[model samples]
Target: FFFSAFHCRGIRDDIEEEDEQVSDAINVSGAAPPKLCTSFAHFGFDEQLMHQIRKSEYTQPTPIQCQGVPIALSGRDMIGIAKTGSGKTAAFIWPMLVHIMDQKELEPGEGPIAVIVCPTRELCQQIHAECKRFGKAYSLRSVAVYGGGSMWEQAKALQEGAEIVVCTPGRLIDHVKKKATSLQRVTYLVFDEADRMFDMGFEYQVRSIASHVRPDRQTLLFSATFRKKIERLARDILVDPIRVVQGDIGEANEDVTQVVEILLSGSDKWAWLTRRLVEFTSAGSVLIFVTKKANSDELAANLTQEGYSLGLLHGDMDQSERNKVISDFKKKNLPILVATDVAARGLDIPSIRTVVNYDVARDIDTHTHRIGRTGRAGEKGVAYTLLTHKDTTFAGDLVRNLEGANQAVSKELMDLAMQNPWFRKSRFKGGKGKRLNIGGGGLGYKERPGLGAESSVSYQTLFLENCIISSIFLKSERKTCMMLSHCRIVASAAVCLQPVALKVTANQPPELWGIACLH
Candidate 1:
């Protein structure tokens, strides 16, 4: 019942997929999928909402919006799985505006008619801005409540009577407890970046928030990546919800040109950044993502010393300061910004032309969101990830994502990925107790005596990429695999050997040959 659709952007179609197959059709499951809405006009939205959409210059509904909007309008719960920057915010927000308008106006002291929860404060603020932009025609009063800002101010705004509230989990919970706001009136509930919320350990807070909302509320959960935990959470919250999946989860954004650079070590990143800093800055706004808050500050200080006027943003900064930095970066006053993953998820700045990963992300999901900061709203973007040997733990997944998006995988990065201990274990499926004959003096395979369970080389085959193994058996320097010191290579005139067979592993590519040599 699942149908897949590609993000209708300038994605490359000519590149042939040689690894795992990636489908372009958007998948919709659960009951009958709602009819896809080709345009905003199909929704028959309020005139004011239509005007705001037109003013936003939306040419057409995105893949997620096409299917998600209709499902949401049906008043059924929904789980939207799509790549980042695929208009997921609007997929739920548009329907939410329609839902809000249909409901009676909020009485004094009543909480928001719709409550949208996000993972980060930045995302909370961004969604609140969207609520204001689109809800203006209906005279909607939306307030953003999140941590880092003054609690008194947020409480005052909430107490002033808001029909829409966009906020983070902790802050929202605080307001609910203090009686500053109530979820009793929230009929339209949204969990934006649901996976991220779960990742940040907000599962309890999210469940707590949802518990306060009416059980029959129309719930929407959207995310770029989904996990088993998220699925479990969805089951607990949503009822008979239709699932709309656009593009592959954890797949790299095809609209962004991804480049991976293998460095000698982590320390070399500064030099690499310095070399391209001016070029990237001159082109357009650049966002440099680091792993730690200290890294962001240190990098920003170094760049400042080099006379580059850049902004620094991290969790350590105060909310007001961070807001100013984001504002400056967005307004083009600061062309360069050094930040941690705090700005990675949902900071929608169209001016971000380039994203440089000063440190490799810890996981594929985080990496996906980090690069997603650049390529947004159908604009072409470029992202560069600087990797060292230490970061090759996730190199295999990175290579797969890159290949899945038809992005170029550098030979250095590919080699490291293959050599990585984790990748090797996955590739060979934990080579243990398996034995194959290694040729000695003769060209044909012969069972060597006493080469059974106790043998050092227990693996049956060895995988080689684009390497040439001659009659001379080069020592197997790979730490993951055992060396076949007992066997000797015999030169033969016949190119093809006898019964010794070769086959490709399921996770690996066809070109990756698994061969047991005459050694």
Candidate 2:
């Protein structure tokens, strides 16, 4: 079920303008002292630290950074629940870097001071990159350790004495067990995307790694959602830490427009999907969500065979393969990526314009995370769900849960379900099936051989031109719809050749003259 409350415009401009005015009024009258840099500046950070921030082009601090940075700098534990892409990485990294830089020099055999554990290798690499960028001016050293790569290289980096280590739980634990790296002297420990790690069944590994770290170290936990499990885990790890909750859990971004299309089992989901792709032709990139890894793989294969530039990612894939797929997808070399839940967590891609749930998720939490992939960083995004009869109950449960969270389902979506057929057998069991016979042509559009007298509007012929244009311009949505709409308008216009002029009069909205002429 699509929810109206899930659609939000984010930080209303009017409210922001009002706040700016109020702030100016207060400042002009000298009613309050300017907010001092009581946070980082008070911590005795060197000039190099400030210079690094300036070089990184960071103009202002996010709320997490503003509050959590100081506390973490003070060597206190912290638990933060902020929305994805809220600059949480920097919040933890900056203070950690400051501490490392202030140490001036380490003993000949002193180990790393901080160890940052992320759920995915991608996130581990991302965190490592950000740390390096921020620590560049201070000449601080950092290394990323994750599976799917040569351990030799990572060990070499570790042997060189990195002050900070960003790693995935499993790989880091491997190193710890081998005594290749030691966290005995580490002063700070961070669990980034804590919920995802638990969901991915990394609890044991994370706990094992944590046990190796000093118990007296400051522990920081950051996640988008804080369920009972996450809260309990935080309690076990953090010591009387400050809690900062910036957004509601499982809340969809307001800037995303969500729609649900109910379809019968026999209905061609591919056709419906093709139509939606056309509608969102101008969107930068699209992520299609499927239930199983096999389905994601098959879908990507079929789409690619149909001439669509596509990529596939799933847990079963090797780390190197997954990294390549993600890299290609992010660079827009592959416009579409079929993926499972693994890609849904802590993967920040700002250019994703749309998300399509080819199959409804089994649970509300999964649904929330899938759609949350788009509509990031204050950008407008769209999400569509292709629903079938078998998914009704699951969809209903999801809507009910959202309602409980103050998000109401859209009545329009519920009504839309009635028009679609619901009970057709799935083409594939567990989403494993042969690729459909989508003929190859320019821009994923194949021309059919036969044309009849009554075949006035051939989707193949009409869409061929549109597809070429769309592919060249990256307009998948427009390609899907332009042909159909053009055919309808052309047929109607052929019936009457009268000069019909649409006009917008002084005070009236524009009126369509063709409809009157049709009558």
Candidate 3:
């Protein structure tokens, strides 16, 4: 199974037959949940290791870590389902360190004891850095190997006896094929962002790499979304793993405020983006997502010409350029970077305060992943997406997703949705007559009623100077009748054949004080 740009899809439809086809859930009991983690002391971590964790500013264990760390330490396989940026990396990292450090030092030609596989080079680097910190405390060396990196440097690092190896599937397969590195002693295996790996069509390579590892190794799979497809992959790899499910699957980050702007035309998209950069974003780093690799560079060039500081990250660039752009982004020097879907999956940039979908993603999953780039590590973020007529196919899903995330959907966007047949059929009923948009702009009425000439009344009010009338048949020089606002009705039976304007009286009728006015 391989992914191609033409299809813009994930894995092949055919699910490869597995050696064992057990698809049922397997539960393992480990440490109970703690409402809050005061310190790492209660998790059975060494005093030296605890110092590193504390120095890293992880004062308390996040929910995933609180339960996941203990289970991983128990030497049980784990399938952790948590939202992105929920500290899942640290969850497996902490316990994997404990296991690796307990083992004796590796010989000069020996293999790594722990192997962590991620979908992209950026993620591999991130996980590798974390492992290095904890491993360094106990003199356990770790190395990161991924495609686009120097093969010689990676092979030499492996030869030096790294206790832990964090790498992507394709690069790992290359090293294994060349006998540059071996997974013979790998006791702890982690698949971070497992769904993304499968999405990129790395199943064959992942399984091929797995063949080199010991069968008794403890495997762990962590995914932001626990979809049925992800579950199938988990069944294939894990052995009766402990299932730790927390948070809504594929839900947008709570700290992110999502927005969808339906444009009248494609040309308006750039104008909207420029306006947003100048007005929508205020103080934080911004990430702009484009639909294609070319758009990334084009948008970056245009924005840069406009005096905004930005860089580009896409698959078309050489690994060196991508790394430099990522480095610049991390350093906050290039606060705004235009990127393609290649930058979507788990690239952590904690200071990103906003994400702009210069081109709205093709699917809701893609949109969620793009928006996830911001609001990472519990920081607040806002995402602005520009939508056009071409993306009508996804309008229904986009609206529901925004509403599901508790974000406001614009009335104009909903009005545009009525034209979409899918939205009209499936989403019309429950959503009808519900217009929450108040002052931003909109007539505010949910439905538009057609009126014939005889049934219609024209409103012509020049002034209301101390004059009160529940029912008014005002006659101007040109217009004949006046209609009440919000469908207020008139009780008078007689029609005003000859309309007359009312004059203001200084004093209100005494009886009016007791009666509430309707008009």
Candidate 4:
């Protein structure tokens, strides 16, 4: 029934998929899979634009581009899912540019013909800069609208005319409400990092701005992860959109190595992290994410005092200050940056060798993006972390993410997993017991009397960016969203580990779980 609404006239004979095994995640109903292009020329890009593509050093289409560009160029609405740093921006850019070029020439000081909305200021500028590269080849006007810059300049740029407007939702909403920008002529709408925009509490603003756009416009939604909100939104607006999932919906990127260390107390964190910083200082550029704005300060100071170069970034900093920090860090003048979650999702820098979680992230999505800051564009990178008692409460999600990243799981983590029925069930599903149920709804595991309520990890809470083992998300009227903080178990619980034939009895004691051994 769903497939009947989609038209199949967009398939081109020139493009050919490279005999790739399609992921089971992609669901196109009856439509044949969109043929992936072997090269950019297969899509019939203009010679001048192709010149710009090469001058920009793009040799060929990336995976997301290979799959997404063809469908997009076919003039069909699309929902593309790929991990961060996967060249997603270009995937959508090529098609949007082609479509714009096909139409009558846009005049300066005229309403934009296309709108590309994203979640952050950094990403907005990045997309706009990229658009200009291709748009300029055809003499198309492109501008970025975001907060923290001169509103007068942005308003003037919009008034003077631009065919492409890459903007953040909040500022764009302000512009639309103020009558400074017009979207009446917009025929192309893109929600880049759609999941992150919703995650950041921009749903209402996005929907409101989207309401102002013409319904006949072609829409494209791209995201790294898909939550229920994203799925629901897609259903409401996208008309039989072609779903192009480049990778598993929530699968972790394989380019980064995840490392975890057990920290017994707050006293140990500074000393432990400082030693790592000293050793890693010369290795490459680094980004350290702390949970609180205040935490960024203390970590930055300690690192500087320890003779390591570092910069700080947080929500409280002024725009100019933040820009300077990011600029210095990217310039390699500041090799290390201590930041809060504000910098987690968007800000892409070059050659960031490692991402340090000085403070444990609030959720699995946060964790996924934090690690994504490094290991971009297929470069090898590392995500180092200090796991404390407060954080071990999420041992299930943490362990699965580590294992998914192909890191060596320590015995301590394995023991923590042993105590978690959710972890045992998911982490060893194929090898161990079938799904177990206790009472009416719980897992068949005895809860330690000291741990309070009995619970199991909500399998439904697992996101496609499959780093998280399990989670339970709750909606809030005021806060937008919050994940359940209640944990299944704690350290005092008894555990026994049987790593293959290397089995250890419960009599060996839980404290011994921390001892090092060959995995």
Candidate 5:
């Protein structure tokens, strides 16, 4: 599945080639009609707004924008499932802006007409910026509300009559609780990254905010994955909606090349990571994901010490610090971002070329989430995993699960690993130790060094002698023994034998051989 971007460079090239071919055809056939450029003058958009679109170099509407804009302009609920970085922000923002500008003639006491809630502060800011850019034609006011910034500043912005507010769930809920902003007059609501927000357990906050909006208002839900839970939430909030899925929801970025490298127990995983970083330094930006916050911090610090520009982000950091780290990474001042799962989700860095999992994820879900940081918006990217002995089992399980889900790891990556010198020398071998077969007749018998001819001994006496010898060995090894009345002995030895298995007659008197023999 693919999501095509209208103004993408690749798409522009294709259009250019088509235009050349069309001109050639027209020259050959004098009967061909000349192409005409239609203006948006008759669409009722403000003259200045149309001018701004032209100034922004937008010639025609993208497929998503063309389809979504009209519906949103009509104040209809929409569910848009498109590939990440498909200009989805503009698809929803343009119409919303047009509608708000159309309603700007309302009295001075009017409330906000639109509210866009994103899962992360970065995305919220991105949407906020887009809205400001598209709404430049009118005196439209917009403010971004997120936890990392000052609440007082946001309140002030709201009080000043910001017509549109793009915000994160937590910060938006705070504003609602403080009564600093009223959504009762809101006519448009957008839930961007609805699936991610639910996964982050922001359901209650989202519901509370949704409760404040007018019941009859238009609601738009957008996400990469519109699974059952997102559908359920949409059912609870949206009216009869126009559902748009541009591509397969489960389809990952095809341009991304993924590889898993299994390592020996004593190998330095950090060294392998540093080498990959060096290799990727010439390839735009890189985002490295680690499982723990402490690991992220330590790894970032170590990378910095090694003369690589890197930033760190985790849950333990305050909002201000997190914002700074993200800002630095986005500005390319920091080429690498070592982050935990919390900091990685919902981030909108478009130029990231590589995503490295410093450690194999404990589960398949986490593995998928981590690699998703790269190869966004149809850009070619790469994902790498560093696996230690302890991670082998989990990595194998994750790969198998992904295959079962029809997201197979690329065989090209496996071939690449086979050619790598490091992989050749340190690759993981098969399971250790040979399987022992106990099916032979002499399986339970330990052969003595020499056979001794002794006086006649009863069968029960011989069994008791053997039991005593086994009990002594077990006592020395800190194991347990269970006796069977059928003259069979079940003795468990440490480091070799399986757990004791015994069957005793109900009438048999069990003898207590030694205290140490009982586990």
Candidate 6:
């Protein structure tokens, strides 16, 4: 079906009947598991907690909360994978409160019972807010520690000893080193947005923090994306964990209508954006995403000079100023926000009606997160992307994702995807008397007449070099050999194939370089 945003002046209010039926099926895989809790009452939570759930107006549990909360309550490690804005925060927060409340009270000079570490400062605060929202039911204490805020104030909060501590990696390590907080007493540890944390180069800090926690403690990791590094990290820390996958990993939310428009160049983006800003912002709050921090400032300045008041958010701003900007945006004080990727990951605002990619995302995963900022909690939302030729590397992936969601793909977008080398089909056109056959093993070349063993070997080497250069986009190792003995391209058979060897060093694009030889 066509995305309605393209047909109207603003975000289309006419959502299709089929678009409303977003899939809620979840796949839970592991050893023996507890019965799935379809509703909050199934968990047999405390009466006050039940009242809080009702007061919050949560009618039913999200897919992740249905399966993941019970697993966490079973005292087993878990890796919760779901799309962003899928209520993943509440999935772990509810269980963590139960785990903390069942334990003894914190004593003087002691640490929190639960430690939740995420990648960004904004996410750290977001999780802390969630912790407070639910923890208030049990009169539980929670504190948020992150960078750019007052370190001494955070240290004071730590020294006072809260039952739950939400923080980012760097500041938490600093607190640990200063003896402001101790992880030895922590029995419940969480790595929210686990993939992003590791992606941002927090592996060493995360591993170090995990080492300080009690070995027998319960660990949990929650993220919208899962990667090889996260899998390896889970294996090292978790003890027989259950994997709760809410939906297909790396796929955009079905509730979001993605519209991609191909632009001639970067210079055309500003004009395209200016024409749509009035209609988009008039409908509801709009978030404009840029690739760099400097770009966020520049765009915000340009917009303000045009008499449009908007909020600006990036990592460079101090914590207080950033907090104020986000507060104003959340209260609907500002109708528009220009932000960098820092706001792309875990900062959730349900009122955001549309997200605009002024600068195309650097990678497929980033693109997924950028669109995820809208269409939260099954609310219909729209995302517009401005694409140029320089972003062709990820165009193929973007097109595939759109098609997977059953959204309409434009001809211009399909043409760009076809032009990408990684997705392009290879055609072999070579000299006569040489037959090329590709099989499960590798490429094979049959022999031709009037070619000696030595010359055949040289031709094979040249062919192998061509293969390496052609498939340089692949990251994995390829072991292949060619056995061709023909040349219509070269006039003289004597000098047709030369015995030249090439070796790609470690700095090359592909991680592994293959050494080819004659069979």
What is the C-alpha local distance difference test score of each model? 0.72, 0.61, 0.66, 0.66, 0.60, 0.72
Work out the TM-score per prediction.
0.77, 0.69, 0.74, 0.76, 0.65, 0.77
For candidate 4, the TM-score is 0.76
Off by over 4 Å in 4: 1-17, 21-33, 107-109, 406-408, 421-519
**lDDT value for model 3:** 0.66
For model 6, name the residue pairs that clash.
none
Q: Which stretches of candidate 2 lie over 4 Å from their true place?
A: 1-57, 400-408, 412-519
Q: Write the per-residue lDDT of candidate 2 for residues 453-494, one digit (tens) a residue.
A: 111111111112211110011111111010001111111111
Which scores better on lDDT, 2 or 4?
Answer: 4
What is the per-residue lDDT of model 5 for residues 323-391, given as tens digits with 9 covering 90 to 100?
A: 788989889988888888775556778778888888666555456556667776556778887766455
Query: Candidate 5, 372: how far from true, in Å?
Result: 4.2
Clashes of each: 7, 11, 0, 5, 0, 0
Name the weakest run of 10 consecutive residues (lDDT summed) in model 1. 434-443
Q: Which one wins by TM-score: 4 or 5?
A: 4
| Local error of candidate 5 at residue 93 (angstroms) | 0.7
Model 5, position 64, has a per-residue lDDT of 44
Better of 3 and 5 by lDDT: 3
- For residues 1-519, what per-residue lDDT tens digits would candidate 6 score against the true structure? 664535542222232111122223665555544335555655657776778888878998787777777677656678888877789888888877877776667789989889999999898988888888888899888889988888899999999889999999999999999999988768789999877787689999999998888665778988776766777787678765677766566667889999998999988998998889999988789999998988998999989988898999988889888899999999999999999999998878988999999998877678888899999988889999999987776777777667555677798887887787754442122211111110001111121222212111111111122221111111112221211121112111111121121222223443344434432
Tens digit of lDDT per residue, candidate 4, span 223-304? 8766668877776666556666544455456788888777788789888877677667678898999999778888788777
Q: Candidates ranked by TM-score, best first?
A: 1, 6, 4, 3, 2, 5
Compare candidates 1 and 4 on TM-score and give the better one.
Answer: 1
Q: Give candidates' CA RMSD values in order.
A: 21.1, 25.4, 28.6, 19.4, 29.7, 21.0
Q: What's model 3's TM-score?
A: 0.74
